[model samples]
Target: MAVEVAATRRRFTRAEYYRMAEAGILGEDDRVELIRGEIVEMSPIGRRHRAFVGNLNQLLVVRLAGRAIVWVQNPVALTDDTEPQPDLAVLRRRPVPYKEREAWAEDVLLLIEVADSSLAYDRSTKLRLYAEAGIPEYWVVDCVAETVEVHRDPGPEGYRDVSRVAGTATLALQAFPDVELTTAEIFA
Candidate 1:
């Protein structure tokens, strides 16, 4: 006899996810984030990834100090079903600290992902997620390629503008023209 059964997977809302965390079902050591109603395990940060994020954080903080808040490896509430902790998030300056309330998509000026082992996931899943959230700008620092991929002009369909800058080139955000970052410095 042959038997067939269809298996169903459970999808959780943001509130439910938070409840799980509060109830101690999820531990502090867990490297996970909610993505499109599913709990996705995040890759461990390698040396290159950590160094890249650290450098970017230093650069952005120095360049945008008092102008924007530089958040490193922190969660950004994208939607009720999605809260992703990007590698770095440049947020709008708020009267109250983010510790009082986490930054939502609307507060995000720029989101960056330093992609090495997670390059494919960052370029595809994370890209779509950020675009759907209407995040103004997104950057994927492709360590393997030694280039940065910039996405802008977000819409329901996705980012209308996508460009790649080589390691030797410089990148300037349209929103902040005064802040320019060289790819070499970022990838270094």
Candidate 2:
């Protein structure tokens, strides 16, 4: 008689994930993020995606100014097992510099992901993760469709409010409603 045993998987903590980078197990060039204790390889950023991120970064920095800090392509430590490097993260300005400590979920005012090819993953997996972490606001910019999907009022079940905007529609951050950007400017 033959018996079957289920395969087991090992999950790494945030410290272990960093140790992997320090020990050369994972290089800086490797586009990956720790999601629920698992290292997930991120999709390669295309030209359009890169452009959108850049535009958004510039626009946010100029508009938000001293109100918030615009962090681009940096990791926000949501939990011990979940650290995601969002494309653009609008963080609450504080006396303690980010160099001294990483941005936590609570410090995030807005998180934006420019999804050129990973729209599905961004809308589902990342959306749920941010919502569960109480990120407050999240935006998934779909490059192919030239639209922005906004998610707000997060709960354990996910975002309670979700909406999509395209064309010349004005898009504003939930935290900073005064700061606005148009879909045309985003896709341009």
Candidate 3:
């Protein structure tokens, strides 16, 4: 029997990704998902997915401070090997962000991913990646299960504390306590 090793390709830089986006090949609404070193075509966004994202964005913006901007569907640059476009990113407001330039992980305060069908991938692959970057907070909105998986205390290995916020449970932001959002509102 012969053993074969899988070869992984290096992820493209923000500049390179912009080139591909500008090339008009990915399409306007193709639902393509990208993470560390990989570009993937994600499952189509259903109505539930859209609703959840919209609601979360509004809640975060309303509850959080004005200086903390709520970014919707933007690529958070982690490294040359990782750039995952999170669904909702609560970042410190910058004069120029995805509005002018790409937002990097350093700019991010909280990263969120709404997972319906991609729950496994979100918890396993994406979770580790975000932790590796030492993001303060990471939320995985598991639509199917109707739960919010909050990852905290990020280290090189990954997030140490994994809390499941269900029902009326709330997630308080590290920088903003007034930014209290309900688990139901997010899953709804």
Candidate 4:
């Protein structure tokens, strides 16, 4: 005779995740993000990905200095159980400095992910997550294809508007229409 047993997994809240970090279970060097109440290890950044992030940061900062804040590799709390650090996030200029409080999903104007190794995850998981969180705009910069996948009009199902920008096409943020970057400059 044999007996049946059930197994269950534990889920963590954002507070618990921070507690883990405070207790030394998670370290500053650990590249992990909270996803749907689970701690997920992030993909290692490649040279191409790193270059694109730096390039985008430089371009956005120069263009939207006073208009918006360009956040680099910083975590934006999407929910009580999810906080993923994006490659870059354009945030609305607020009176309260971000140093006083971390950014929330509503603070984001545009979120960007540089995809090389994590292309699939960025497209599927991150895209859906950002959409569900009501992120106004999300961009996936494909290093391999040298293109940008733009998503807008977020909803519970996902982004209602999706488009690919390539060649000499200009990429502009919905929040700041005047700010633009051509694909040529992006790929370079």
Clashes of each: 0, 0, 0, 0
In the range 113-132, model 3's lDDT, one tens digit per residue, is 89888788888888888888
Candidate 3 overall lDDT versus native: 0.80
- When 1 and 4 are scored with TM-score, the better candidate is 4
> lDDT of all the models against the reference?
0.90, 0.93, 0.80, 0.93
- Model 3 residue 177 CA deviation in Å: 1.9
Off by over 4 Å in 4: 1-8
Q: Candidate 1: list runs displaced more than 4 Å.
A: 1-6
lDDT of 2 by residue, 1-188 (tens): 87888885788899999999999999978999999999999999999999999999989999998899999999999999999999999999888999999999999999999998799999899999999999999999999999999999999999999998977899888898889998878888
Q: After superposition, how far is residue 123 of candidate 3 from its true place, in Å?
A: 0.5
The stretch of ten residues in a row with the least summed lDDT in candidate 2 is 2-11
Q: How many clashing residue pairs, candidate 3?
A: 0
Which segments of model 2 are wrong by more than 4 Å?
A: 1-6
Backbone clashes in candidate 2 total 0
lDDT of 4 by residue, 98-153 (tens): 99988999899999999999999999999999999999999999999999999999
Off by more than 4 A, model 3:
1-11, 95-100
Q: How do these models rank on TM-score, best leading?
A: 2, 4, 1, 3
Q: What is the lDDT of residue 15 in candidate 4?
A: 99
